[model samples]
Target chain A: MPKRACYAQDYTGLKILHTLYDSCLKAEIDFLDDHYLLNLIVDEGCIKGAIFLDSHTGEIIQINAKAVVLATGGYGGIYHGYTTNSYGSTGDGIAVVLRAGGAVSDLEFVQFHPTALKRSSILMSESARGEGGYLVNSEGERFIDELKPRDEVARAIFRQEQEGKEVFLDVRHLGEEKLMHLLPQEVALCKLHEHIDPAKALIPIKPVAHYSMGGIEVNSSLEVQGIQGCFAVGECANAKVHGANRLGGNSLLEITSLGRFAGDHAHQYTRSASNKEANSTQRDKDQKAIEAIYAQACTLNFYEKQQALGKLMYEKVGIQRENTQLLQAMEEVRAMQEMKEQMGIADKSPIHNQNLIEYLEFSSALLLAPMIISSALARNESRGAHYKIGFEKQDDKHFAKHHIIQWKREI
Target chain B: MTITILRSHNKQEEAYPLEDKERTLLKALTDIKATQDASLTFSAGCRASVCGTCAVRVNGKEQLACAYKVQDQDVIEPLQYHEVLRDLKVNKSLTKKTLQRSTAWLQTFQEASLTPKDEKFSEKQSDCILCDACYSACPVYAVNPDFLGPFALTRAYRYSSDKREADTKTLVDNVQSNGVWDCILCAECTLACPKGIDPKTDILMLRSLSIEQGYTDPTFVQQSFGFDPNAGF
Candidate 1:
């Protein structure tokens, strides 16, 4: 097989991130390091700028720009405890886009990587299988094809765990030298996190929420469809390049390629002479909204709801989805949203208040949960990552077009 | 289990008696934040140690919170020699400046093909996560605050060794002042690096490379006998 992607050892993403960050620094770009995005500032469908809360001082600030690009990443963090995303991948940008009356597309197609470290939900890179690793059950039987697509492999592993058998990634045949030479990060991670060296031991693994293929809808030029001067790229924008299922290693390609295009288009948009008025009213509204969150009665703990959301998303709306479970998940998420008024943070410090940030992030995830579940329910076919139990076959005839969800006031 | 965390907000150590369960320091800290104190602030990403945002000092040793297992009577504090944002969260903005100051990336986008053997040469150096563990552990930062710390110099070595890098002269010039020569080579950074990257050796290699470029140690040049700064005799 030909190599689909270029890699710098096992730390490809890290290397790419460092290169980009270095380039930004060398270019003398101004960086607001600890600012947390609060909301977008849009006036008459044209994006003015955004509002952010300085995590250090807890002061709300608004910046007005001619062109705004949302590269804030994906919604995989919505799954919480069962996701391989970062602590801050709470779909805040996607939710903010929706609330600002922008459309979100293909949000139901969430790709679950077949092998995440079972304990910490950390990703075990796909190269494990690419390097001839085997997926074995407790009985040491290879059940499914290890080389299958991500969604199928994830479902097979999910089925095995459902039948009360544990699945493991057996790479012992690869030998210690070969394992270390090929996948050094995997070896170090298994040894340090699980206390099981993969060279000698069977590494326990499971599928977890890894990537969100769906996000804010964008056109060929990577601009958000309805909103002018607004562009969403990377995981935050659904450019329809991946459709329902994204192939492994394609996301990096998408980000690098479309990310550049988004930047270029945004820069071009800024160059055009349009001296627009700043949306100062939205900043005040956002500030009041944040203050309101601080004033809410602390009747329901946000952490409990956040954990419950994770469990609910993983169990019900996860790999094997059905109509009843989808409906149940939808109702539960809506109920949580109804009780949102009672959920408040105990920490009121005007500093790096993680509690407040997490509370805001959870609220964003909560707002997008129904959108995902409803999209899953609307599409009654198993296509790509959306594996509906009753409709396991892809019915392209009915669900061929893009499934888009716009925030409606009547919800 | 008793856990003592250096809380930055109140400038004191706060202890929490936690249940002795199998968990990482990050999970334990998160639990404390959720149930015990909501005012606790820490940074974590990718929980897998790949992102490297969750580094904290565990009993005076730098460890990624997600990678380090929790033990009884474990003490956790923010990384050393940096501005602390809160409990266990330190400002990492210095990493960007140091990397920029070192000119650590390829100077020009010249294309060069590489075989497996070529890639393996600098493979170890490419594994840095910029977690700042090495920066936190280096004693040189305590004195010379402007020394282009371990991770940056290692990155500078990474690019300088790259086959595609056309010019290391500018990069070598950039690291002359507070760059490679400033390293005492204590290897404290090598021990603290969670990714196992050897920055001390990389700095030594940079020093040798500097000599080939007709540059000597600044310390030797500044000595009274080596160079007559007073212009006497």
Candidate 2:
């Protein structure tokens, strides 16, 4: 309890910003253009300077840099109902890297943090359990021990859900004063939004999608495999340090440490680059693709498709998945992709067009969703965040190796 | 079930049968009004606590109308000190204007070299929905409206802490001149914050940052150094 109180005190000192919407998109664009020391253009078999697209004007701004760092976050948004990650995180960097012929490793592994705010799609940080909060079932029974790892807690919650009992976080022992100080946001959310107080009432809770264990594979130097001059960091790049499961407070630590490392490495790499000239022909093709994407975005009935995708993913590929369900999800995603292509328009005007941006995001999400479902199905092992009901046990012999996915040549 | 209501305005009490399976405070109020024109007025939006628009006093404690499900008998009143325009709506323009006066949006730096990693440092502060749940809960705001409160001071600290912002000195100077540094650091703001934004800690950080910038609160420095005017004279 004292440790919990102290942790709450510490959080007060740390200031953080949570990205919700266009900010994530803008941040990616800015980091690629204004901040990066090197822009790596991955095409066919050659790596060169990256061509930048002015998202505002639809013009290609070619830049010559020594190296490129991908600080793009994770793929939690690919899951239908996730508690941890921001909604906008949908594996854009993963798709872009795959498109550029960069090798991706562990594309199937995903981490599901247990103890999301019960009944709501909000994450109750593992810090909560770290702070001495206990998990309880509908019968007011202390069902699971608090200090269990995230993977264990997630599985426990899933079991509880299957048994037809509502799982809740019992923080009533912490008392109102402590609850108010330690978890003011959660306390307020429950009291005001859910009309339940953690100090006096049991919090309705459930496990939801959390973190992506799979990403563009990179080494200690932060360089992506098979692609020269490109580096991936943060949740965007799978450093394999986290292996299958990530520890609490490790994410912030990982982002800061790896982000700086990648930035520094990119700076050094850019400084050493012999080729400083912009490839005009490649730049032109990239420009045309950007324009075509913008045009296609305008006429797309994206929201309807997005909703359908969300529902399908939630039902078929959510927390608990089987081979049959994943196959259905794959079929549905392919059909949706065809519909998305047919609905694509050719409007070239780019005036702060959010619709166009959302369409691009939706397209990226659609492409990435199948990768997750298919990867989930193929892994067929109970390891870390991925739980396969058909193949219940952790099959380390066959599934020990990471699942790698590459884009089909024809697509 | 028969529900009883306690009227605070004229100390009147009434009872009515509640037919609805789930009866909230707002629903109960509607029923009471329908049967009899009880002159109870309050503000509400989203009927959810997310908006922070419908905060009121229920049974001597501050609660949101959109939240706080009503029981059989519940006493409801408006928030204290602020002039209530009607039943429960208080003039929040004063606090809003104070934030504007602080120029909370002014960033000192045009652009700082920030990686996506750098963005994570102050990311939680940016998640502020500006519910003013902290404002209502702050004891300092209740005692001194001009104390710069939690939200405004937190906003000031947010920009000041940003490496990209260039005008940290101006911000520090503005806070030093007033009662901004006089905050007791009771952490009521932290306790009241619904988004987990600890404005109290933000204030402390701002004070430290301010001290680092050579803009120290003269009174605090003098007191700590044991400087007495009478002894000096």
Candidate 3:
């Protein structure tokens, strides 16, 4: 196969990031590193900049801008340990947008990659199976077609696990030379993390939460509806290009294509829009809310609650869903919100308080969980990633439309 | 298994217990954070090692926390010479500066063509994750903090070697001061790289290119003991 001179094997994403970061530096772009987005300030359907927490000094600062474009990535961290998402992928941006009355679509369609390494939840790429690898069960049988869509393979692996059978990605027959030449990253990951060489032993594998196909709704120009001068792009925005289950490589497509549109539209908006001072009332409200969270008594463990929520979402609202399980999941999610009053941070330092940051991320995840469950429950038929047990067929007649969720609206 | 972590707040090494399980060091740290202590702080992203946010020193060697397997009695610390943000977290704000200082990105362009061999040769140099493992490992920082370091020099080399670069001389000139010629050729950065990116060789290549471009080693010029104006007499 002919390879491009710039292609760096499986590290294309890293290479691109480095290249972009370098380009940004060359362009002399100012970067506020180690800052966390606290809240997006919107008043009268216009963006009024955003609130940020400086992680270095633990200071809340507001930067006023005419337009706000959120490229904050996805919300796959709700599955917690069973996800390939980073710990920071707690859907904070999406949750904040929802709180600001932004409509979110397809919140139920979380993509699950089928071959994440079992112990570590590190993703094993689809090329592993594409290279004639077999998805084998404990009985040494090929239970599911390895080349099926991501959702189907994930559901199949989930069913296998339910039957008390462990799944492994058997690629030993592909030979070591081929793996080294084609899938060096996968081979290296397996050798280092799992301690089992994929060329010799079966790689213990399972489905893991990977990508979120749902996010804050955006139009063709990547502008958020109902909110002027507010735009969302990348994984945080549902441009509707990825309808239910997104195809592989389309995330990058949306990123490059819609990302350009977002930049252009945001630039044009800022040209005509007038900047306003940060809303003092909303800033005070946000500050008081954070202070109240800090002042709460440490009775319930937030980590335990997060763990429980992750388990519930993974089991009920995960690959396979049903009416009763989703309802139970919603009830439990609501209960978590009620239980949030007793949770407080143990790390109260003024600098680099990761505990506070993670707790806030958990709060956002908790806020978004009910929406996901309700969205999953409202769409009765199994379509794409949302697989309900009784409603297994894709019913395009009634439930074919995207399930859009907004604040104070019924699912 | 017990993992000792250097806490940044008090500057003390604290030991945490981990259950005997098959897990990466990142997972163990996360487990400790979730169950044992909520105050434990570290930076991690893209747990499969694509994102280089989780690089840490395990028993005096740089390793990505998400890629290294957990071992008993492993002492983990933040990457050396960086301002520790918290426990096992260091500020990488200077990463962009390094790239800027080296003029790492393609500055000049020309219409050109490349062979498959050129792609194969450039593959190793382009895999840098900007994790700063090489920067943390390089002993050059102990002497000169302004040194452009490994990944930046490698990136400079990556662009200079490209056939599309119209002017590689300026990029080479940019790296002459605090950049390529100062490297001690220690190979520590190469050893520390998680992606197996050989920054030491890249720096050496940059040195040869610098020589080809009529650039002299600044250190050698400063310490020219045998230079005499009357040698021709």
Reference contacts recovered by each candidate, as fractions?
0.92, 0.02, 0.88
Per-prediction TM-score to the true structure, in the order listed: 0.97, 0.64, 0.95
Model 3 chain A lowest lDDT segment of ten: A1-10
What interface RMSD does every candidate have? 1.3, 15.1, 1.3
Q: List the residue pairs that clash in candidate 1.
A: none
**lDDT, candidate 1, at B53:** 90
lDDT of 1 by residue, B1-233 (tens): 98899987688999998997888888998899888888888898887778879999999999999888889888888898888878889899876589888988888766999889988888888888889999999999999999999999999999898889889888888899988989998999999999889999999999999999999998877774656667777
Encode model 3's per-residue lDDT on A217-335: one tens digit a residue: 88778888757889999988888887788866667667767778999999999988975666676667777877777787888889888888888899889998999999988988998
Residue-wise C-alpha lDDT for candidate 1, range A1-411, written one tens digit per residue: 898778765678887787787778778888998899888877777888899999878889999889999999999999988998987898999988887778898889999999998988888889889889999999999999998999999999999999999999999999999988878888888987788989889999989999999999988888887678899998999998887888877888888898899999999998882788685887898889889877877877889889999999999899989999999999899889989888899988878888899998998899888888988999999999999988998998999878888765222
By DockQ, is 1 or 3 better?
Answer: 1
Instruction: Specify the poorest-scoring 10-residue window by lDDT in model 2 chain B.
Output: B33-42
Which digits, one per residue and each the tens of the lDDT, describe model 2 over residues A1-120?
344222222242133222211233223333222121112465444356566545434456776555777767777776643444554577777877777777777766677777666444
For model 2, what is the alpha-carbon lDDT of residue B128? 62
Q: Please give the CA lDDT of all the candidate structures.
A: 0.88, 0.65, 0.86
Instruction: Summarize candidate 3's per-residue lDDT along B29-147 as a digit string, tens digits.
Output: 88888788888999987888788899999999999998788899999999998887788888898755888888898888899887878777777888777888998999999999999
